[model samples]
Target: MTTVHQLSSPWRHDFPALNTKVHDKPLVYLDTAATAQTPLSVIRRMNDFYQHEYANVHRGIHQLSMTATENMEQVRQQVAGYINAPDAQNIVFTKGTTEAINLVAQTFVKNQLKPGDEIIVTEMEHHANLVPWQMMAQAGQLTIKVWPVTPSGELEVSDLKALITDRTKFLAVTHVSNVLGTINPVRDYIQLARQHQIAVLVDGAQAVLHQQTDVQDLDCDFYVFSAHKLYGPTGTGVLYVKPGRYEQMPPWEGGGAMIKKVILPTGTTYNHPPLCFEAGTPNIAGILGLGAAIDYIRNIGIDVIRSHEDNILRYCLEQLQHIGDVEIYGTPKTRAGTIAFNLIPHHAYDVGTFFDHYGVAIRTGHHCAMPLIEKLGQNSVCRASFGMYTDQQDIDCFIAAIHHIKALLD
Candidate 1:
């Protein structure tokens, strides 16, 4: 346990935002679950693209347009390689994880479900995963079933097994819980869903930062995540469709590059699977930044980052547990980078604000998982999550702020 205090990240300098001073003190950023601090490499990569190689892609013959198109396509391939996707075509770019899930929900899953068919979602889902299915189920007169979370904030496979029936056509579950810090065994769930011939979509928004993702290994019909959460620019995301699934999904949106050809006053043919889904001019600079972010992760290796963050998470959990008033929410056996808790006599907002005043940043609220919060018998909780650049000093600063706030409030 003493070695945790000596552990420090060598890559802390890569993120320029960590050097920022909040209220005359160095920033102690513990809110990576909300959005990670962008590294200089991603910023520089986007700036260079906008300054030198700026142009629209896939619609022009000019040199700049060709260069931008090549770069964007290369990033698509890079994303594919990063996730061990079978082909680049399986990767579809979207505005973010929310849009990606909606795309699958509205088109692919919706197409398959009948009026009485059911879609299963877990209580731990973010609104992105839950709301879309709810909307679709309402519109189509389909039933929505929930897989319950245990008292310890972990999911039980037996609960899911009991929920499955012939009517279960689709399942949406998170690879990791953003609020509870639960690393769900989604691959096993996927296998179970496969046995019942149900399609599964794994939301990887929180998992990608701390775990090495392999789409083929998970074998989900669809996987979605945002680039921003993975240390890239905002407004960019990836949705990977399994082989042969895209051919079944009709385009969710239509315009611009998503068409093969438009015949006015007649029927129009659509482009291939991914291009058909991407619609309109994409986020060119953001996609390039996403490529740079993946490159950055590759250079340092995901295993190394995971080991570093696991230590930080273990230490942070230990420190929080040492404080009697602190009530940690989830005690999942396997978790990665986040912990949610609240001080017994203090509201989460008060504690978070106090932390902010002392140059510490932590997320406080439902974390867009209101149903899970309600299940935990709380309206909201404070969350502290780690990143690849998080180190022992940051954890020390955060712990000290917690003690300071406790002393004052007590």
Candidate 2:
């Protein structure tokens, strides 16, 4: 592992929020797992759209609308390339990862699920992946089976094999555990499900920004992730549907943009796959910002970003372990971008509140992974997640804050 001093991020200056202050102290943001601070390029691109090119996409023949439509469609292609999807037509835009998963649950799985049909989801899934399938199970009289995680926070392939029966129809799992920071073997999971003819949807909200995501390589039926986690604007996400999978899914939402023809009393004809899934006036400015975000990552290179984050995570883990009182969770074989832990004899919320006073921003609580927390025998934990811009200085600040908290609370 590289020393923290030898691993400063060259891209720190690109994110303006690093200079932000709280209680007159420079903000040490370590909460990328929740949402990353937007880079200047993404901000400028969104501002440029609102200032000069505001228009409803795919609705008007006017110049502004045409320009917006063209730019949005280009971004659709960019997203497809980002994940190495089979085709641009396979990408569908949504509010975020939560909606993307829900979109599939409602359209693709809902209609196909029969009573006694089983859906397999891991215990480490964030609520976004778990709740949607639970709702589907309730509505369709399906069974939700849990693929248990080990105490070290890894899913055993044998456990998955046992859970797969002839009745299993779908598998919804996370690419990485947002709480445990464990990078699951999604490829293995997908391959197993493929053999059984079970559809798979990978919740990629925590994986995309930290690693290069190739949907085709993963060979998943559906892959979902949020743009905000990748330094783009919020309220924008991508759902990569396999070529065969999209052809079978009906429109989850119906409106003006998704429909080709609607004869009121007669019938209705829908547009193509991507458009059919995207209803109403989409987030044009946010989509443009997402495009800029993709360009920004490409310019820096995902390999560079992943290496930087790896160093930061390693340094953070070492510091936390050295503290002696800090109880880290999930000693998985491979982890990335995030480290979750609890300061002994101190509540996670209290530690987080003290951290904020020192301008060290982190997330505390269940992290939308209540079941995982319960499985770990912890009610809540503090998470320090890294991004492309995280550097040694931020880690130092966070370490100093931890010492301060221990001194005051211990």
Least lDDT summed over 10 consecutive residues: which range in candidate 2?
1-10
lDDT of 2 by residue, 1-410 (tens): 57756579888898998888999999899899999999999999999999999999989999999999999999999999999997889899998999999999999998787899999999999999999999999999999999998989999999999999999999999999998789988999899998999999999999989889999899999999999998999999999999888766888787879999999886999998889989998888889999999999999899888888888888888777779799999899999889999999899999999999999999999999999999989999999888888889999899989999999997
**Local accuracy of candidate 1 as per-residue lDDT tens digits, 1-410:** 83854468888999999999999999999999999999999999999998999999999999999999999999999999999999999999999999999999879977888899999999999999999999999999999999999998988999999999999999999999999889999999999999999999999999998989999999999999999999999999999999989877999898999999899877899998789998999999999999999999999999988988988888888777787799888789999799999998799999999999999999998999999999999997999999988888898899999899999998
Residue ranges of candidate 2 with Cα displaced over 4 Å: none
Give the C-alpha miss distance for residue 274 in model 2, angstroms.
Answer: 0.8
TM-score of 1: 0.99
- Residue 276, candidate 1: Cα error in Å is 0.4
